[model samples]
Target: MTTQGENIAERIKAQAVSLGFAACGIARADAAPRTADRLAQWLSEGCHGDMIWMEERAGQRGAPQALWPEVRSVIMLGMSYAPSRDPLALERACDIGRISSYAQGQDYHDVVKKGLKALARWLVEEAGGELKVFVDTAPVMEKPLAEAAGLGWQGKHSNLVSRDHGSWLFLGAIYTTLELQTDRQGQDRCGSCDACQRACPTNAFPAPYRVDARRCISYLTIEHKGIIPEEFRAAIGNRIYGCDDCLAVCPWNKFASSAAVNKAFLARAELVAPKLADILDLDDAAFRTVFAGSPIKRIGRNRMVRNAAIAAGNSGNGAYREQLERLASDDSDVVRDSALWALQRLSDG
Candidate 1:
């Protein structure tokens, strides 16, 4: 016979599914294993790079309960954003810019947080519990909590990978004061696969299950707020917003379903293999207008143009020389520098 708490958990999960979550599981708020020491070690190694916020919030990020003492249960939810086609398909097409699949559509933080709020409200009505919803913005260690909730295990790429959803999940968490039955933890299914590591264009991973964020294309493009280091510019290729090479190369993705349950995750027609020349044309107004609801807008016009300049340089197409030359005197120093480099690369070729 199921206990009352188990029955309530089942009902809450069912409600989450109805609210469009791909999967939902409960975990004890304090279930994170080695939560503090591991984070301390990663920060100590300086793997987090320019993302100083991670270091600042290291104490609270170490565990969920530490952030919110009253939280008895954490409801972890997964929403799938699986692409309709191969993520690696556009990698070789130099003229077109490649966006990581997650940023190719509407911003997931908005979409996932909306669903999280709805679920939290429903929980309040059904169980009368104090709840706080969080997406990626919080100090919570969502990946570990998701693993503890049986949603998925952190893969070799240091991302949550589900047997059902692969690595295509956007995670959301709801911390509740109500006691809830916890699910069994997901086991590490990655026995021996280095495909994700081998596929990294810059070898961002120094060892298994570890990533040097300083060398990661995603961090360099989106998070690092300065001129991207020239050493990794060539390897950055056409990826503008983020790089999906590690996630795309996971063998476990073979089990991933093609269709996305959330329409918000589906790629916008313009973002799918956008031309470098076109992206180079986006001014501040045009950039904001084009990516108003997309995650790409967060990087701002200068960074986007900077990334486009790098892509244009790697294109090996002399046709974009004029565009590169025009941007050589751009207002932003990073853009001007990147554009000058692109012009030189093209000139040398």
Candidate 2:
């Protein structure tokens, strides 16, 4: 008694699960009025930081149909990268560096996008419709669409929070012309709890569900191309790649499915607690080799070294003086400046 659309939708969900997605749902492709409004407000407030692309493609990002008019249904998928242990264990591991759990393995963009493309291929073969798959690269408002599709709700930290997988989900979206059945939207369950906001090292959250990237450790370390402000340098601590305090402190993460179930997200031993000295010594070629398939590779050597220098300064160990001194002459002005600042902090200790 099922309609063709219902049958196709059911099969697609099954296929997505088989393809390693932790959760899958469908939503009608339409303009997201609320998301668009919030994006406009966020942009107007200059909260996007150096991510100019967020402004450049605002129209396409605001509405799914604007990116592809033929799209009738959006297939939303969630891949769990939940960590097996506490992500904050290294908070005081001064001599060692910490990488975000999500970035501790092969880039999720490649892994999740591969699954999305496979699902898209299956949909085309079975349903005979045009489709497009996106995994973070495009101007797609993936989190909003994922929530609309019932995969999860956007938590207070502005990231998707899944009941089954917690805050450690990697999101992907597929747009298709097929008129698929849509799922009911997920409800906001974050009522009253503000653990994520209070946990921020830099107080990056201007308010619940709003973030100021200019003061965000993730943005300062990964996106900003200049010297990090002295004000935030100490609070940055040893997080060299990305910040995880907000996500780690979320009460929802207690329900996170283990890493064994999410094989692709297993933490690499090398990234777990990399020696700051070793990282500070990496040149361009060494940096590429170390982060070959990791998300940290995107920032390249200068930025990674720059972040490492900041961590060294905050270490207060004073043992890293030689390494920090060497970096004081790094070719990149930003790295050189950070290294000089780090040397001063170490000297004053």
Candidate 3:
């Protein structure tokens, strides 16, 4: 005989699938007890780099009940954004900028949150419970929660890796007052494979499951505010928006198919491999216009141009020298600084 809670859980998952969620799993509010301590340690070590928000809500982020006392269960959902082509294919194209697969399409924050709210409404009608939804904006430790909900385990790269979706799942959570049946926790299957660690251009992974975000190309390009450290600039190469080296190298991706990816996450043609010259030419207005409705818009023109300058320098193409010279006198200090460095690099060669 099946319990009422089990039936509700199954219905909730089916509803999530109908709403375009690639995966859905549930766990008790306090499923992952160690999440708090691990997060505390990671925060204490400054592994989050310049993202001060993580420290602001540390307590609430680690424990779901701490954030919402009424919450009894957590429902984790994943939307697959698996790339159609090799993410690292643009590496040899020195004059082109490689945008991370996730940001190449519509902003995931909007896409994932829309689905979450829809699912929350369906649950309210079906099970009659108070609920709250969250995406990456919240201080929530989504990967750990996903693991506790049996979606996948946090892999050696410190990213949730699904046997079915690989490392390309966009996570969202629904904390509810409903006491639903919970799923078993996901188990680690990484074994002795260290492919993710070996693929990092900047050695971002300090150990099997710990990532020092300070050394991560994605952090440097998108999160870190001021100038990027000199040591990692060359290693960043043509990747201006974000880096996917670690995620792309995971062996589990063999099971991920582009067919399973949501249409909202498909790569935009212009962003797949944009020319460095065009990116460097973007002023504030141009950048806003070009990236409208895209996640890359949040970084703004200054950071984007600064990143393009660095990639231009690494390109070793003399054709970019004039653009770099013009950008050297740009208004933003970071953009000017990066442009000057690129000019110097070109002059040296």
Candidate 4:
């Protein structure tokens, strides 16, 4: 005979699937107790780079119960955004700027949060318990929670890897007051595989299960606001938005089918392999118009152009020199500096 908690859990999972979530699992509020200490160590070592938000929310992020004392169970959900094409196909196309698969579609924050809210409402209607939903924006450690909930294990690249979805999952959390039966936790399956570590263009991984975001191309191109350091520019290649080297090379991804991808994450034609020359000329208004509903809009015009300039520099294509010269005089210091670097690189070549 199934217990009341198991029945409720099955219904919740069914509801999550109907709401377009590809994976659903549950865990107690106190699961993954070691996450707090691990997070503290990562912060202390400064692996997070300039993302001070990680440091500020350390206390709440490491533990779910600390964020909400009344929460008895955590529902972890994943939405698939598996790419239909090869994410690394543009590596040799020097004139084209590569955007990460995730950002090639609509902003996931909007898409995922909408689903989370709908699920939260359904849970309230069914169980009559207080609850909260969160996507990536929150301090919640969704990956570890997802692992504790048996969604997947954290691979050596420090990303959640699913046996069913591979590395192409967007995690969300729903904290509820209703007691629910926890699922079996995921076990680390990355026995001897080091493909993800070997594929990093910037050697961002300091060790297994750890990432130094300071050297991460995704962080430099998307998160870090100032002028990118001279060191990682060459390794960044033509990747303007985010890097997919580590994620793309994961052997586990063979099991991830493009058919599992949510429609909301379908890649836009313009973002798939944008021309560096076109991206270099985007003004503020044009940038907003181009990336209106996309995650790339959050980086703003200056950063986008700056990233484009870096890609241009790495391209060794003299065709970008005229645009580089124009951008060298840009108002933003970072954009101007990157454009100058690109111009110099072109001239040197």
**Each prediction's TM-score versus the true structure:** 0.98, 0.98, 0.98, 0.98
Q: Model 2, which residues run further than 4 Å from truth?
A: none
Ranking by lDDT: 3, 4, 1, 2
Q: Kindly list the per-residue Cα lDDT of model 3 for residues 124-183, writing each as its tens digit.
A: 988797999999998788999999999999999999999999999999999998889999
lDDT of 1 at 241: 82
Model 2 vs. true fold: TM: 0.98
Please list all clashing residue pairs in model 3, or write none if there are none.
Answer: none
RMSD over all Cα atoms, model 2: 1.3
- Pick by TM-score: 1 or 3, better one: 3
List model 1 lDDT by residue over 1-349, tens digit each. Answer: 2376787899998998888789899998888868788899999999999899998999899987788889999999999999887888988898999999999888999999999999888888888979999999899889999999999999989999999888999999999998999999989998988888898999899998999999999999999889999999999888888999899988778788765458888899999988899899889999999888998898899999999999999888899988888898888999999999988888887
> Residues 244-321, candidate 2, lDDT per residue (tens digit)?
999988898888767425587788889989999999999989999999998899998999999999999999988888
lDDT of each: 0.90, 0.89, 0.93, 0.92
User: How does model 3 score by TM-score?
Assistant: 0.98
Candidate 1: which stretches are off by over 4 Å? Answer: none
RMSD of each: 1.3, 1.3, 1.1, 1.1
